[model samples]
Target chain A: MNYETPPLLRLCNISYSHPGTSASLLQDINFSINREHVGLIGPNGCGKTTLFQLIMGLLKPDSGTILLEGNAVTKSRDIKKLRRKLGFLFQHSDDQLFSPTVLEDVAFGPLNLGLSPDDARDVSVQTLEQLGLKDFEGRITHNLSGGEKKLVALATILAMKPQLLLLDEPSNNLDPATRERLIEILRGLDLAHIIISHDLDFLAATCTTLYTVQDGSLQRCEQKQVHSHEHIHPYGDYPHQHGT
Target chain B: MISEPFSSGSTLFHCSDARVKVIGGTVLSLVLATTTSFAVAMIGFLFTSLLLLISRPSPGLILKRIATVNIFTLFLLFSLPLTYGGADIVQLQYFQISLDGMRIACLIAIKTNGILFCFLALLATSSTVSLGHALERLRLPRKLVFLLLFSYRQLFVIHQEYLRLHRAAQLRAFTPSNSLHTYRTYSHLFGMTLVKSWNRAERVHQAMILRGFDGRLIPLKQPQLRKSDYLLLASLLLISLILAGFSLNNPV
Candidate 1:
């Protein structure tokens, strides 16, 4: 007998539309990921977030099948099981962090997973230490700077020890130094992740596979294709790369 | 901005366990509120004032807070003596002043100041999150604790949203004045803020579910009450009981 492990995540024939809308935002989308760092890039409001919501089971797809580790995620219990192995980081760190303190926020997921208070706290401390946030345990969540909040938000997910992470706009609104630090952290992580960002350079530095959502479909793009291009400006014609 | 200026100190009140402070503060406030004896109220006021001093709050801020509370008491002092009816009446220029009314208002003012001082000394020393956790440990309703924690977290977000909207209005050269246009613009700004907050709440709820959040929010670190915390609680309770006893023996 021959058998192989299935993909980490699989979406087959997925389609979704907003309520009361006739046009589908995402249509006939089929994608799969397996133990590889992936990057997803697209324009604003092109259903990138909607696709993530479907994957996280926040919104039910109009027509589709989502498989996590070869198990179909249809029922609520199945979705809960899938969530145990999948971590979704929101685009807005403010929305992702609801706890008043850093340690509490990081420990939230572990506590929800039925870990004891001591074990969850230990996990939270270790996660924060891994992220170079050792002294941030007692920091107020609302008082953190933008970059610090983003890193703390990532720690909250990392504490859960999920198999795959889905990070939405991880590099949004970060300063140059903090963005560089984030890139290094993402590259150092051993688990697989699908990062959604508008920063092409960030994607190139962190992801091994690149995908773009356009025209309601997911398409693979070559790294070589993301090169400098000439464009006409009001002042003059100039060559510039994306995300300059 | 809602600032917790007193929350970052290293005084005894700050170092004590939040649960101890919460219980002590609540008990003291209850005792003071129920007491009608002038002597008991004065003693409680002095005790709370000493506690506030030991907490080592900035002198200026503490004075400002006391001043704000006293403003309302000043109004009571001026109005109560003239309006309240009693046997001991004194004739003013155009009204009768009741000595009993004056006594009652003075008692209320003293109790109010005492409670305020107690709250500032004990409760304000801990951050709101710690207070919520302390309340949870004290067997308060889980939903109420959640509501307090979540609302405290979202207050900053909502405040920031409102500031952004106000900034946008300023960029458009909108100015406030006694005019219908200004009122309309202010209403629109408030409406937009509410709508944005509603949307953000939905997104935050989704994020919570994605993290496998069940109905309960478990606190990670449960602070143990140390010997000092126990000592402080015992002292406060003793003071409260003594004051209650004195008030019962010498009722107004």
Candidate 2:
């Protein structure tokens, strides 16, 4: 049987809704991500986070299949293979990191994969070193600065060396210096990525293509074209909800 | 100096066959715990401590873990002698309590500290996940085992929320105070944290169901026991038995 190699991630007519909520929060999320540094932008409650959760396998679609590398991503068995191909940097660093120390936190994913204790430990140290966070190896994670915690979270995923990096709000809670370091780190890593952020400048700087979540659907926008539109203001009315 | 060996270690303990750790460690602890012999407890403590040391966790980590049960010891050390009555050196006037407190306090401290120390030694070398598995192997109910697992997951997530709350408070202008007003604010904060946690838990449960996580968490691979692991278990039981035998006879 000749089977075509699957794309990195594909959502075919995917839709989901909360149990009691009548409205479908996400519908027809039909997009195939292969090699673009895709920036997903939308106002709060516009299904941006929901899309992320679907990709991360934390939430499943109510009506469609989300595939990783051409394989269905529904099974726990598939998640191991899918996770090997995708690294999800959760928006909340605390949720991403549950371990007590820096090294242990970084090692969580690899150890979960059943890598022997010695091998997992080695990979964690190397990942931390590559991120220039060698000094943070033994520090208690709770004492870390906002940016440091984010770096640690990213490192936790980086250790996995996934083909597609799924990041949620990479610049949130970061100082400019740390943000720059993170941006550089992301730029240096050669992998297909889906970065979700509200920061227009960050999207403009790193993304080759921008996809905005609007009206329960994600629409890919034309590159180098800024339409005259009311973008979502952080502290004001959200753009996606305002428009339809 | 901070070696969080427990947190970073494999799903080995988490995914390991339950019988391996629970039946293994508990039987070991039981043989050791009920034995009132000083030699076995001391030898078990030393032997278990050596095993933990070989895990390469830092000295500070070991000490910090051992220190957690000190609260229980504090009560035993202070009140045991007074309540039980120690040597008659000092006596309380109002309630007529005598001061044979020192000797009784020593006995209680040693006894309590010894049991605690033995358990610490076992846990230091083993993971709780392994212990949980051991219980399941010993025919503990599946629902109870899962409840333990779910609560463990909840505890960590709740801890994360607490950190966020504390950080938010620190960022705000409000100074920490012991006044009634501050205490009221603290209660309010605690209440908010609980509400937030419940909402998150609800979301997580839905997510779990969506992902087809019905009651059981059948791991991809099963745990296999090696010859050396049994050797280690055997030596442990032997040492525990000897310690119990000696301690009971001596009662020191």
Candidate 3:
């Protein structure tokens, strides 16, 4: 990594509120990501996903600048450039994998990058093979098993060969075996990614840095502080560790 | 779960190019629909039936589908003879049945069945994705094809969402009945499903943009038309031309 180069992504004083609402969903979110795996966690409705949407230009920030590779993203063209460098894996695999077949869905990003159909297919095939899904090319997207659909959805993003990935709940609905496979794949990837997941174990295994969004603010959480401890619930005398 | 059961096969129709099948199916159906002569209609029906047989769909499924279509025609069969006025009439005690009306109804039933069999043999043998690509290649509007392909893809998602909502309601002891409460609950369930689907659509759109999707959906593979496909197309056109000639020569 060149020290002279700027961070891969930078956000400055970012704030956002839903239209027609008084309260802000996010406020003064400042962060920068280098070539490193980052994990973002928050309680439900804490604006973690909204932060990602702002980064990806899906939703504009009310006040702030989003920088991609040292350039300010202030226009549609700049957003497009940012998008070219960033691949966002949606929370639901069903939403991400819209094409009929696995190959088509995987090829979609490459084709949009202006590759010819044959070349796009070649890249899609290579991406699938890299992810151990060589035989899934002809499988219908909707008919795929939950685990298979998740892998294929990841493949769709990976086919674009982005410099960074924004993954939202990649391991949400996976079985144990599949989740293990996902962890292995994520650990093996060389590209930087920011994963938003409630599964702390999943984040601990795959991400180098963890961040938490609370009360419309983003703060870094230390890795050493992510240990499980016995705790009692208000409704029961039994004590158990979280995520047991 | 929704599925395209007929899309997987190795028969001639299954192996044929989707564009050819689309063209052949359209021409044959148009011919069958427009023809008025019984002779042409019967020949077209036999031809489509033979195509259906060659495609090798499950006999039980084919019978069920044909029966479903014929059920509607059965209404026509019963009512047309009584309602249609003609010189040639069969007198019953309280009503008169027109022979021409009966003939025309039978012709329509034959034509409808012929078209149905033709589509099942051709269109259903290929996956809807390939069919959408074929339509695009045939110079259909790109937006229309996109609409068709997207709608087909989203139908299952929307259905699953609806089922999940319905299951949640069921878990809450909400039983659907012929009552205002049931109706209200059902409407709320449907409305929630729509809202969820709308949000999912927005997320999907964002995902697409994040992955650099432009306006066009380019297909990865462009299926090539082979000799067999050309032969199929030629034979279908020849059959259609023959049926058209028979109809023109012997008008109803």
DockQ score of candidate 1?
0.70
Residue lDDT tens for model 1, B1-252: 368898989999999999999999999999999999999999999999999999999989989998999999999998999889889999988989999999988998999999999999999999887899899999999999989988887888898999999999999999899999999999999999999999999999888888887767777767888999999999999999999999999997
Predicted candidate 2 versus true structure: per-residue lDDT over A1-244, tens digit per residue: 1236657788888999977898999988898888779999988988888887777777778898887778677778786577667777777776555445687667656666657667878888999999999878888776788899999988888877778888889999788788778878888888889999988777776778898888998898876754676555676753343310
Q: In lDDT terms, how accurate is model 3?
A: 0.89
Question: What's model 2's overall lDDT?
Answer: 0.68
Error of 2 at B172 (Å): 11
Residue-by-residue lDDT tens digits, candidate 3, A1-244: 3448888899999999999999998999899988889999999999988888899899989999998878899989999988888888888887788876788889889899999998998899999999999889988787899999999999998899988989999889899889989999988999999999999889888988999998999999965664456655696666644332
Top candidate, metric lDDT: 1
A best-first ranking of the candidates according to their DockQ comes to 1, 3, 2
List ranges where model 3 is wrong by over 4 Å.
Answer: A1-3, A143-145, A173-177, A222-244
Worst 10 residues of 1 chain A by lDDT: A235-244
TM-score of chain A of each: 0.91, 0.88, 0.91
How much is the lDDT of residue B237 in candidate 3? 94
Listed for each candidate, the true contacts retained, as a fraction, are 0.89, 0.00, 0.87
Q: Give the distance in Å from residue A87's predicted Cα in candidate 2 to where it truly belongs.
A: 1.3
Off by over 4 Å in 1: A1-3, A116-122, A132-140, A143-145, A222-244
C-alpha TM-scores of all predictions? 0.90, 0.62, 0.90
lDDT of 3 by residue, B86-170 (tens): 8999999998999988998999999999999999999999989889989999999999998888888788889999999999999
DockQ, 0 to 1 scale, candidate 3: 0.67
